[model samples]
Target: MARIMSGVQPTGNLHIGNYLGALVNWVRLQDQYEAYFSIVDLHALTGRPEPAALRHAVREVAIGVLASGVDPERATVFVQSHVPQHTELAWVLTCLTPLGDLNRMTQFKDKSQHQPDNINTGLFTYPVLQTADIVLYRADRVPVGEDQEQHLELARETVRRFNHVYGETFPEPQVVKSSAPRVMGLDGESKMSKSRNNEIGLFETADETMLKLRGAKTDPARLRKTDKGTPEVCNIYSYHGFFTGEVQRAAIATGCRSAQLGCVDCKKLLAQNLEVVKGPIRERAAVLREQPRRLEEILAAGAHRARAEAEKTMVLVRERVGLGAPRS
Candidate 1:
């Protein structure tokens, strides 16, 4: 089986968009591949968060992962910082990465535009660390969305560059495009993100999720319940494609165009379906949150397993680079 590695930044509460777009796929991938998932707290550092808040965010992400159906027993799940080889390899890869390539990264430019004052070196070199995260594990497949295609390309290039200099040290990771639906936020303007305050958190109560869905934006042209609207243009209808069955979605589309279904009732149906799917996950997350020590132990064990693989890779890397003491 191909080795798969991926991670999520512990920035804040993960929304339904995150669950459907990434975490849901991750759970399925774990059963199909040798998967390693991490709470990338290191990446979160670019924002310059408070230390205590960072710690909380890390734990919350881990809990979210567990609640979202990532079985620690099936897949290696840990904190990124727990395996030191990630950063160690990052430093080496950073040395080999071209400054011009880093400068060309679209994400870096976008982030700089967003937070002009705090455009630190760490932010610029984020993709290099991401390259380390993948190559360190010798992962052959990386599941990612369209937004992250550039980063994965960088990772593959980094692998080829390192192999050229260091001699066949890492496998070029390939992109496993997510089959899940691309989820939009309540605002229907941009991706569902915590910073935008448009997310329905994965672990939030069903009622809370329903409230957000009920208020979510639909087709702008549709003014009243009597107006016929295009379901294809509605963000809420896109969500229905994920949570609702095909027959139901067809019904919703027909109802929408016929002015037979009001937006409020349509959203209520979405909430009901979403709850049916997410209710178990919320319950699981609640239990995991309560058992803090169990969560810690799970992470500790995952770290131990990840360290074993990372150390083996590092040994080969060290020998290739001639960085360690000469063998007797």
Candidate 2:
């Protein structure tokens, strides 16, 4: 099977957009690929999270991944910090990467501007570390969103530069995109994000989910109950490409255009449809929460497994770069 690697930052709550866009695809991808899914804690540090929040968020994100059905038996699921080679290799790749290349990255610029008060070196050099994460396992494919296209391309460039300088030790990674991506936030002004207060947590109770949805943005053109909506432009309808079925979506579309349904009524239908998907996930997460040791065991085992392969690659890399034999 072809190896695939991807990661999620343990920054905040997993939302509906995350579920439909990323996590759901991860679940489906495991059956077809040798997957390594990681909680990218080191990557999150550049964002400058509080220590306690980072710890809690990392564990909670891990819990969410397991609850969301990233089976350890199916994929290598671990934290980035567990495997030290990720950093050690990152250092090597950084040496190969050019300053001009890092400066040109758009995400780096955006995130850097957002945190102008504390623009750390880590933030500037993260793309190299990202390359290390993918190339450490020699992953051939990575599932990515539109926002990550440039970063993925940079990772490939880093791999190519290293191969040209020190001989080919890593393969360039490719992207696999999702078609039915969840795009809108609770505010519906931009992508779902914690900073924007536009997300519904994956483990939120049914009532909480409904409450969030009720307050969320929908087509503003249909302010009155009798007004007809264009489901084509509505975020709620956009979500249905994943949450609701073919028939449900068709009905919603028809109802919206024909003025047969109100926004409240449409939201009610989506909330109900959501339960059918999130119900089992919530149950599994609760079970895992009770057995916290299981998460530790899985992570330790993943680190151990990942280390073996990463070490082998490092040995070969060291020899290619004329670092000579391993110390006795």
lDDT of each: 0.89, 0.86
Q: Positional deviation of 149 in candidate 1, in angstroms?
A: 0.3
Global fold similarity of model 2 (TM-score):
0.96
* Deviation (Å) of 173 in candidate 1: 0.6
Q: Which regions of candidate 2 are displaced past 4 Å?
A: 180-182, 324-328
lDDT tens string, model 1, 129-194? Answer: 999999889999999987788888888888899999978878889888898645678899988888
Off by over 4 Å in 1: 325-328
Models 1 onward score TM values of 0.96, 0.96
Candidate 1 overall lDDT versus native: 0.89
lDDT of 2 by residue, 1-328 (tens): 9999988888887776677767888899999999999889999999889999998888888888888988898889889999988998898888888899999889888887878897999999988888899999999999988888888999998888888888777888999897544477878787887767888778887788899989878888988878888998888887777789999899999999999988988988888888888888888888988988988999899888888888888888778777765565
The candidate maximizing lDDT is: 1
